[model samples]
Structure formats: structure tokens, C-alpha cells
Target: MQSSSKKETIDCFENAIKNLNNVRTLYTENFVNWKGVTKDSKEYYTEIIAEELINKINNENIISENIKPLERENYKVPSRGKTFISNTNRKEENVAKRIDKMECGELGHILYYQMPLKPNNKIKKVGKIDLVSFKKDENIVYVIELKVANKNETLLRAILEIITYYQQLNQTNFINSFKDDLGDKYKKVEIQPAVLLTCDCRAYEEVEQLDERPYLKELIKKLDVELFSLSLNIQSIE
Candidate 1:
């Protein structure tokens, strides 16, 4: 929803976020009761809520020039390293950029550098997914992992992460933890796991080699993660 006034838009967004927090709290507290709530019911409720928020914001008619709805199916990834910044420790940010561009085209709404998958207050847990996108009301979002495609620590860790995200769909609590980041802008957002193996044939071969190792393959297969090999030439930095 577009708003004509910037002030109204910001206010509307803030109010929407507040409402979302309340709704999630209600859901969590009444999980057993709400368990019977069908997906369509949830979607309809959220859509109405979202529309109200948008109208509230638009009422002021002070539109922010920067606010724009994501376009669908014409996404492009920016030159890495330069345009996009990543935590030096992980390459997920860069990999996600590529996938978003590939899947959503330029019209994707990408949320990058998300808070660590495990919040600071929680018990020690592996970090967060690299990116999250709301692709203009599309059915799926790409949960990307960027790691070297060899028999290394990073690759193995990424595989685990992809599965974690996949399993997250079933964990209402864990998914709610992300509500702050996701906000209430999009409804029916579903994450699809993807691993962008950022390495050449040598490294790619290393992963393929794991095929013979039934255990490793089994673990990966369970997660239903995809593998995309990016050339080392795919500079993450500009």
C-alpha cells in the first residue's frame, strides 16, 4: 500500500508493527485454541489488518519519496563487496543477493544483515539466515546460505543452517522471533532454502564427492536444500 504522506506512512508502519506484536502475542498465548485457525483465516485477518494500517498511514498524505513497492520478476544483484556489505565472518549476505536477483528480479523486497538467527538473549545457537525477501506477494522466499563448497567447516555449517530454516516453518515460536524483522508488511510469506556454494569446480566437486558418504548426503537430503555453484569470479565485492 502506498501513502501520499511521509508522516502518515511512518506512523502507519509504527502502528502496524505494534498491532502485529499484539496479534503474535495472542496467537502464542492461545496456540492451542488458535491451532484450529485455518491458513486462509489467518491470511484474511492479516490482509485486513495490513490494509487498515496502510489506510491509516495514507490518511496524512505525506508520502516518503523513498517508499516504493517491490516489483516482481526483474531482479538484479548488485556488484558484491562494493554495493553490499557483509560481516567478514560469513558470506551469506552476498549469496542471498544473487539468489534474490535470480528469483525475484529487481522487484524483490530484501531484508539483509538480519539479526543473528539466535537472539542475543537466547542460549548459544548458530547465527541467522543471510537474507529474507518478500517478493511482491509471491508464494516463496529464498533463505540463502553462502559458504565455500568444499569439505570445510563453512560448507558443513551452511548445510545445517539450511535445514534449520526449513524446520523453522514448523516452529511457531521460532518464526515469531522474526516478526520484528518481518514486520506486518507481507502476508503468507514462505521461506525456501537455498545454498549458494561460492566456489569453483574444485570446491563444487568436493560437495559432489560427499555423495558417496551416505550419512552426509542423507543429512542434506532431509533438509531439501538446493545447491548453486557460483564462480570464484563472482566477486562479492565491487
Candidate 2:
């Protein structure tokens, strides 16, 4: 007969397996549902849940040997100092982090976030790319900027920032540096700039009505920049 503790361990393992399968099913169904909805029409809640599910799975400790089990008496929360930043900047950073964590399929890989850009050998830091990702199969690289604002001016700023990053990345030295970081696999990828925004439904609806819409679209086309938006009310999974 097995000991009580051993029996409990086995039971836990079985339960975990069942939960994993259930989550897998949920992810598959949700992904299919997401595909059916047009990009603009997709709800923030749906995207949040789908992303949370992926994060949950990735957070699971699959390699038991790599993680040491702690005794109840030994477990304690670590102390950390509170870091402060403006609310607006925090939101922008949070959105960028979310995009960084997302899985981009087998061919896609996130290259870096907050990648520095120093133009023309200038000592001052000009700007940083919010997120950069590469798709190996397509030989394409994405330079993304995350914006928490719905304002047209903010949108334009993000577009300019990404364009600057793109230009810096296209430089020979910068390309060589990236090659060193990502290896030779990304040697010949085409870079594309993009702006990602988090806005409420009303703001999103008003975007098309903005006077800058035509000029924005023209600039996007001219610069080969992609525009993407997500709803602002994405809830955190507890």
C-alpha cells in the first residue's frame, strides 16, 4: 500500500494533467473564436482571457527538477522597494511588456524591448523601440511602439518614434549589432514599423473621424508602418 503523502502526490499529478487538458481545449476554442472576429471588432476581454491563459500555462513549473519545493515553515515573501513612475508611462510600459510576453508562433521571436537607438554616433540616447520581433520564415522584422493614448498627436509621436528606430536599425553598424544579438538567422529580414494603441470603444470609433486620419494613413503607407489597436479595459487574471 502506498503512503498517504505518496498517494496525495499521485492524485495531485492526475488533477494537474486534467486541468492542463482543459486549458488546452479552452485555448483552442478561444483561438478559433478570435479568428472569426475581425481585428477591430475583437473585444478586450476576449483577448485578455486568451493571453492570460497562455501566461498561466507558461508560468506552470513543468520541470520539477529545476524547481525546489519549499517547506511551509521556510516559505516567505521577499521584500522589495516600490518603484514609481507616471501613470501614463506605466500603462505604456505594461502594454509593451504584454506584447513582449506573447507567443508569436514557431517562426516568430521577440528580439528585444526598449532597444536603444543612438543616431549618428551621438552620445545622447535619442529613443527606444518599445518592442521588436522577427518572423524567421517571412524574413520580416517588426518595430512596435506601444501607446496608451487615443489622441491623434500621441499616435503621431509613436509613429515617428518607430520610424526613427527603423532608420537606426537599418544602419550597417546597428544591423551588425542586431546580428550579433540574434545570430545570423535574421541577417536578411525586412524591417517594418508599427504603432499599437490601447483605447476605449468611443476613442477607437472616433479615430476614423480624426482630421489626421488621411494624412496618418498616407504616412503609414509611405513608411510601411502597420497600425494596430487594442481595447483599454483588459482585466487582469487573478
Candidate 3:
């Protein structure tokens, strides 16, 4: 049987994940330009919701005791049709900071960084990765792909998607692609590509299966891509 502390921890984490999802949904739904707002004045409401989640996490004493209140210190009301790119950046930075603060063998230790995925054409299939990293010294960045389950198939898809990104944004090809727009400066920016996977799902158990894929192995051989499955277990204090 699960201990009361364990159960409370699971519940707290579940609630946190739900709130995170809500934040992402609101951000995606109202996303427009760089401001991250909706024309219908929904940005204020979304900000309010995010504030509430943060407050609940910060002020609550016990997992199932007093009700949690919403806090607004950490978030801002976005402008209509504006994108949540800034928030995403904040999230990634926070993830990195959290990893930096941890001891060895801590959960959620991996950090992710910016990974852009643009298709050959205009139609976009997946969103751009915000950030991913595996210890600054490890020299591995995960191109995070969040999902619930069935990681074997998901990891395969992630591998292909990252390869496409590699083919588009690498040193040799990008310089020419941006030559007309960037002129001489295009060659000046030195950018190394890193690919990885990030999710809150318990799929790390299947990590070995992912490393064995033929196409995945080939892609890794050429591009140095990596795979990381993230799982967060937050305990609620009483």
C-alpha cells in the first residue's frame, strides 16, 4: 500500500501537471504574434489562471489541507495574439536552474534548451522546442517532445523530426539558405545543433528500446542527437 506521504506527493504532482497543461493550452490557444494575447481580451483571464496555479504551488502548506490561493508575482498579462515565447524561455531557464541546484541522481535533473524544428515547406507538424540540456558538462541537449505514453513509437518519431531539423538548420545548409536575407553575417553566427526528448511521462523504463532503432542509430551517428525522458514527482508538504 502506498504511504500517505507518497499518495499526497502523487496528488500534488498530478495537480501541478494539470495546471501546467492548462497554462500551455491557454498559451497555445491565445498565441498570435510575440505578445501572446487574444483579440477577445482573453489574455488577462489566462494570466489570472496562471497566477492562480503559481500561488497554489507556492503558498499551500499541506497537500490536502487549506485551499491554495492564486499568486500573480511570477506571470504577466499577455497582449492579444502575442506568442508565449518569453514564458517558454522562462520555463526552460527555470528548468536549467533547478537542475543546477540538485544533487546527484535527482529526478528532473536533465535540462533542455532551444531547438527549432521547421519543415521543408510551410506546414508545421510540431511546436519548436524551447530548451533542453543534460548537465552543462555532459554536452547533450534533448529536443524535448512531450507525450503521455507509448514512448517507443514516440521516440522514433522524435528522431525523424529532429533529423529533419538538422538537415535544415545545420552549418553548411543554413548559411546558404539565409545568404540573401542575412548577407555576410549569416556565416558569423556559430550554432551547434542538439536534439533531445522531454516529457513528464514514465517512459524512461523503455529508454533502451529507443536506442536500438536502426534509423535512430543512423541519425545519432551523423547528428549526435540524444533522447531524454523526464518525470517529475513533487511532494506536497503538510
TM-score for each model: 0.43, 0.49, 0.33
Q: Rank the candidates by lDDT, best first.
A: 2, 1, 3
Quote the lDDT for 90 in model 3: 41
Counting clashing residue pairs in each candidate, in order, gives 19, 0, 22
Q: How accurate is candidate 3 locally (lDDT)?
A: 0.35
User: For each candidate, what is the lDDT?
Assistant: 0.43, 0.47, 0.35
lDDT of 1 at 117: 42
Total backbone clashes of candidate 1, pairs 3 or more residues apart or in separate chains: 19
TM-score of 3: 0.33
Q: Per-residue CA lDDT of candidate 3, range 121-190, in tens? A: 3633434544432333342223343333333333333433444344333344433433443344555543
**Which residue pairs in candidate 2 have backbone atoms (N, alpha carbon, C) closer than 3 angstroms, thus clashing?**
none
State how far residue 135 of model 1 sits from its true place (Å): 5.7
lDDT of 2 by residue, 87-133 (tens): 44356666555555354553266666565554334433345677777
Local accuracy of candidate 1 as per-residue lDDT tens digits, 17-113: 4543232122112111111112333322222322443453356322222122221221222343444555563444545554543433432555553
Q: For model 1, where is the 10-residue window of minimal lDDT?
A: 27-36
* Top candidate by lDDT: 2
> Model 1 residue 54 lDDT?
40
